[model samples]
Target: MDFRDHLRKIIHVDMDAFYASVEQLDDPSLKGKALAVGGSSKRGVVAAASYEARKYGVKSAMSGRQAARLCPHLIFVRPRFERYKEISQQIRKIFFEYTDLVEPLSLDEAYLDVTVNKFNFPSATILAREIREKIKAKTGLNASAGISINKFIAKVASDINKPNGQKTIPPEDVIDFLEQLDIRKFYGVGKVTQDKMYRLGIFTGADLKLKTLDYLQEHFGKSGLHYYNVVRGIHLSEVKTTRIRKSLGAERTFSENISSEIYMLEKLEDIAEEVERRLKNSRVAGKTITLKLKYSDFSVQTRSKTLKLFIASKALIMEETKALLYQEPIKDSIRLLGISLSNLNTEQPKSVKKPSIPKEEQLKLPF
Candidate 1:
């Protein structure tokens, strides 16, 4: 038998309309109403929308103005990240009671490895139900969970029964489950790729499985290999316990657009200082410094420089970012200034080490 056939069980847990739901829970009057958690300004985007708002075609990342136009009675609430983080920590504590192998995708979602759970449950499905119940009792919130053999399927399954529900795909059912699934549901396949797949007659997992690996590689390059394995329900990635920080940065939007280069330099100094503080708190350093500028017209530009050594000090970050600032002329009055550091001096423990892969090539684990 292939060793890959005996994979560990994984569960993906996601909160339902997390921010908006929290708002409703804290203030019962907002319950059963269209609510959005984000800025209500002209430039503000919806960070999260309640299920009620979603029914009106309001979605997260939509402009607040557009959301208002869609639902005239939509209620906008500011995001309280600190409060969300506190609740997330509580949820994590519950997960730790079952297993230490938990990968947090965000404050609202996480992946758990329950193949060797502390509770010694024989069925992952039963354990998922218990976890959901515990979450409701402890946090007074609804959570949906998806259980499968790997992260991708588990994550996708979690969405099937959302807002206080759960779904499971046993090992024997993996193949059939994927075959009936639409190609658009595949993880990492975005809108553009979905359209191209449609044009190529690959409309479902069954259709995707019909293509040869060589043919897929020829057309889709490296991602073709990922698709082939995923279609076969063969994702071997483990549930990671620790997350590595790949970059640290901060930015600020000014009340008034700055036209003078001298004033812009002053703003850059403050942003660079904030980046330095974050780097120190993380106890990490990076070799690349990127300077970002957004103009009044909403066009953005970024310049970066890589050094032979890692740096995290304010003086060095400011010096490097300032050097990038003067490299080009200010085309338009700048509205935002920011700086970021990448190429960190830390490496995540991997089941398979891929040192040759470019840092940018690594799949951004949702966090």
Candidate 2:
């Protein structure tokens, strides 16, 4: 394919240290401090940590005690999911104002196909700058953006200059960009895969591009196709907007096993709140509520109730979640508890059917 023909205007926007940044943004006192949001107890893990804490070798998913060992002065704060959700909505509104082709990767990141946008911006680079400016202006938060010919390059470009910065890669520069990138930096190639590739003498994009499809497939299975095309800078995945929630669930592994009903019920309330937030965020109403429990011995059991009517309210969800929790007798100490909402309604207004035209036939027609 001609480089120009394959050229696209893709933008990847990612919020820096999303949860931790939000906390610092709201409270000036927390700025430049080593902060973590989550449980402070020995059992709790860091949900997010500020850059200062990262300098001290602190990281998310590390146990609170471990983080303290790494950075003894780290401050711990409980997560405020509702507040984060509210800010996410605000940022999303800003994205929609520029383009309808926004695909959210998470509450804090998105990919936008701005080849044709509402603002009539002359260039994607300019549009990215404008969007970043708008986000910071409206939310008092920093966002990084990358503009490139495709999603792969755009995602990489976004992280090159983080913490409220933007970068763009023109179509002509795609090959040069990928050639010098470290094997570990390639999209979708995580630590384990990178180590395997290193042993195979595939240490760079240039190295990867030299491998035959047959060789890659023989080694990596289905993912080999992905690695093959990405090295050649060919991506056909569209910015998909029609996402359906397959499951809405919350789970927590306790630091210590608990056999008390009262304590377990309290934890269920927190889980129910998370389930409700996710359900409401997706605007999904569900019919089934499931309760999952894991015993101290690592055995698991589940019980669920299908409601007659779909519900999204927090109170109603908690009521059903709590009822399911007690429905089964606990034979041993519980180490984990979970709540899941499923049987979704994919019947949104835009989800309605439309006439389709084959790509080959449509291409034969002229504007």
Candidate 3:
């Protein structure tokens, strides 16, 4: 299939180590130094790591103690989330100049559909280069981009050339590209899935393509169909401009674990207030209240109850959560407590329809 004939021009742009880069940009002294953000305390977890720290095998989500062991001189700094959001908004304004079909994945990454851009430019490649240049001039930061016929391939390719590079996989080469891709490197293949694929001799896209639909479904369930299609260069997901929030939640990890339910009530009240604030901001309500607890040993437990009517007030939310919390006996000291509301009144998502390609179509060979 010639994606040029039927596919959208998608570009995935990602900021390089966003939080660490911003910190370095603000403090010149931190530039070229091993840096980690928000991971100094004994119980703290690293939110982001700079390239220099990464060279020492430091990574986001690593424990502060472990990161310190990896890179002894790594500098730890608090995260200034407001500043990051300020810069993210500025970057998005630049995206709007080219196309309104921008889907932000996070503060540092987004998917842009430039098939019909403001400039009417036929080459999405040129647009990507220009966008990155504009972002560099505006933020003094480097970004990487992946240009392709779909969001999944674009997201994967963006990571191929990191920091300040970009990779473009044209429609004609997509099949070959996916075929040669490492199973671990596929966009959604996590370690557990990768290991499973390895056991099944599905080490590459080509390997995966050999598996029959029935065999895959029996082994991997619903994900089997997705793997079968993606390897054939047939992804139907669109770049959504607005994502639906299925659930809203607030949680806190306490410095000390509480062994008594009575001691947890006050903490639950504070969390309920936060959840109410978030609900008020979103102007939405839900019928389900779920209470999540993480034990001192890192195990987790959740209890949920669905109400007859959607409720958003803190009083009602707390009342429902308290009932669920007290319904079950506390088995262990709780280190974390969370409350989430689902079955929201917000608009539900509609499935995207597949393209009108005939069954006789074949992927264009790069040779």
State, as a TM-score between 0 and 1, how close model 1 is to the true structure.
0.88
Which ranges in model 3 have alpha carbons more than 4 Å from their true place? Answer: 1-5, 349-367
Off by over 4 Å in 1: 1-4, 254-263, 295-300, 330-335, 350-367
| Cα lDDT computed for each candidate against the true fold | 0.86, 0.83, 0.87
Clash pairs, model 3 backbone? 1-362, 1-363
- Assess the local accuracy of residue 242 in candidate 1 as a C-alpha lDDT between 0 and 100: 76
For model 2, the superposed segments whose C-alpha errors exceed 4 Å read 1-4, 253-256, 259-335, 341-367
Give lDDT tens digits, candidate 3, residues 157-192. Answer: 899889899999988788899999999987668999
Candidate achieving the largest lDDT: 3
TM-score of 3: 0.90
Q: At residue 235, what lDDT does model 3 achieve?
A: 81
Question: Ten consecutive residues with minimal summed lDDT in candidate 1?
Answer: 358-367
Clashing residue pairs in candidate 2 (N, C-alpha, C atoms within 3 angstroms): none
> How do the predictions measure up, each by TM-score?
0.88, 0.77, 0.90
Q: What is the alpha-carbon lDDT for the whole of candidate 3?
A: 0.87
Task: Please give, for residues 1-367, the per-residue lDDT of candidate 2 as tens digits.
Answer: 4334455678999998899999999899999999998857465679999989999999898778889988989999989999998999999999999988888988899998887679766478888888888888999999999888778889999999987898887766778888877888887899889889999999989999889999999988998988888877787666767665667888998988899989998998898888889888888888888899988766779998999999877799888977877786789999789988888775643642222334444323211
Predicted structure 1: clash tally: 0
Q: For model 1, what is the C-alpha lDDT against the true structure?
A: 0.86
The global Cα lDDT (0 to 1) of model 2 is 0.83
